[model samples]
Target: MARPSLREKIIESGVRTLHERGYAGAGVREITSDAGVPQGCFTNHFRSKEAFAATILDRYHERTQAIMDGTLRDKGRPPVERLRAYFDAITERLEAAGWRYGCLVGNMSLEVPEQSEVLRTHLVEVCRALTDAFAEAVRAGQDAGEIRGDLDAGDVATFLLAAWEGAMMRMKVDRSPQPIEQFKRVIFASILAPGVKAGSPQ
Candidate 1:
């Protein structure tokens, strides 16, 4: 097999750099050193750090979407259970990372959206794709009487995704798993429970 190109190697290093230190902190010199490439090699591959980070975000989203599909689209599990499995999978990864790197998409959303329109557009697109997957799972749950029917599945999914980002942020801040537990508890027991009125008594 052919060896990876210097550019590919730089991106491979950039993925770890971006994941570990975030966009702004991932300097070209650091990434090149991680890749064992000269600092000038980075300029040969990426126009700017934003461009390189965008590629890293693309790679991160691809892996994230695959994980989501594995759980959210599993037909053997009940629809609501599938949602639980998805969250569990994410929690395990976050815990393994010691609650750092909350999420590349969510991380970039907080850090880069204000500075670069191109990168911001990429973040928005990735977020929409993730939201669609959750919405599909919620719709399936509603059909199976596992999730509340009155709430619009799309809206519910949006809220769930939004809340999840917040929970991940808190998890990073507190360096604890309790936020994840609370998110699952409140979501399953109340928000997504069948026939439960949102923000009101059942």
Candidate 2:
């Protein structure tokens, strides 16, 4: 195997650091040191910490997008099952990390939006992409009669993202997967439950 380039090292380290520590909590010095590079190396590659954060955020989103592509976009599985599988995969990752670090996108959404307009804009775009992925699956589910048809797919996607982020926040606070499990339970049982159409008692 080949050694990672200096920029790659910094980005790999920055992704882990930023995920573990919020934007304000992660420092340039820490990121460089974690990468085993001098502080100057960060400035050499990235114009600013905010710029570096944007890079790492994109890297993080790419990982998530891969997961979505594999599961949410997998046509072989049932539409609703694909949604469950996606969350299940995410839960496994959270468990692997000991539930210490939640989603980077969700973490940054809470921390950096007010601090950096650059990051805020980037986050908005990232969120839109994520919502679109979910919306695609929701629309498929609706078409398959496995999701409520009356509800707008985009609206459901937006709500799922927001609610999942909130559940992750609660998971971090509780240091348990209960919150996440509850999210899946309620979401599957009521919100995304099959045949539960509009005006029907849920």
Candidate 3:
């Protein structure tokens, strides 16, 4: 029941502020105001805006990873189903946010390069961790005959991440969830389809 410190408050509110406004739009003053702390406190706690954003990215990654772990690592559920559940959960999150904010890592990957390399490195870590989890899940599905194994799991995971991130960008551009839904439909039906093994032409 203890209160969050000023630094913690910035990171907590900074995550939402950055997600909503992006790197260029999210000002330190705005974040501090959202956190209910003075703007001057930001410099006292963090060296610069880039350093603050790195902390926010780490927090965001931990949160999304927890969600992924809950659905993807549930041994009782089939691996493919678990994959669907993970996307379903993400869809709900995007819908709840009125489709305004996409994944923090994806947002930063697009918006932050002009700002700082340090933060970009943090973004890369978030992306790699997500791909690793997806790859493991895909491998599990292949083992259980729930997903095709003709394609390398790592390659498939990389493709899925790339496609999904691109679709998320599309969603933001069009301000519609249609792109994400289409991605889910085609990806599940073709790539992750059960017992799908590519063979020679008949």
Candidate 4:
């Protein structure tokens, strides 16, 4: 087999380091070492740490899009169900990871947005993509009359994304699922039809 592409190696290593150590804590040497690539290879692949981090964010956005594409493309499911299922997928992933690693996008937003413009630029792109995907789902639900039509889908999408990120952070800090459960309750109240209660016995 061909040697793995340098770009792929760098991005994979960058994401792994960022996930395990957070942005500020992960160094180029550490990432390259973990990837089993020489330190010189990192410089050859990326102009700087921020550049590599941007590429890492882009790779994450691609992976996230792929996961969501699979979830949202379930043709037999209703829009509301699909939307809920999308959140369910995220919850399952966090639970599986033991909530040790929250979203890379969210984690980077906290760690590097102030330190690196390149990182912040990539984050802005990620937020845009997430908001666009969310708005599409919200629009679908609105068309189906499952979500309130009075809301701006784009704005609601932004809010929900922010809320989800916050819930993930809270879950990580608290080491409990209560934050996510509370978030789900708020989501149900905000997005679902009237008279629908939410969360499991909370």
After superposition, candidate 2 runs with Cα above 4 Å error: 193-202
lDDT of 3 at 53: 85
| Residues 171-194 of candidate 3: C-alpha lDDT, one tens digit per residue | 988889999999998888776555
Please provide, for model 2 over 1-202, each residue's C-alpha lDDT reduced to its tens digit, 9 standing for 90 to 100: 9999999999999999999988898899889999999999999999999999999989999999999988899898888888888999999999998888889999999998879999999999999999999999889888877787889999999999999999999899888999999999888776555655422223
- Candidate of highest TM-score: 2
Better of 1 and 3 by lDDT: 3
Q: In model 2, which range of ten residues has the least summed lDDT?
A: 193-202
Model 3 regions lying over 4 Å from their true place: 193-202
lDDT of 4 by residue, 9-113 (tens): 878878878887987789887998888888999888789888888888888888888878876545566667667778888888889988788899999888887
lDDT string, candidate 1, 91-167, tens digits: 99999999876877787899998899999999889889989999998898888777878899899889988999999
RMSD of each: 3.7, 3.4, 3.9, 3.2
Candidate 4, residue 139: lDDT:
86
Q: Against the correct fold, how does model 3 do in TM-score? A: 0.93
- Ten contiguous residues with the weakest lDDT in model 3: 193-202
- Per-model TM-score on C-alpha atoms: 0.91, 0.94, 0.93, 0.91
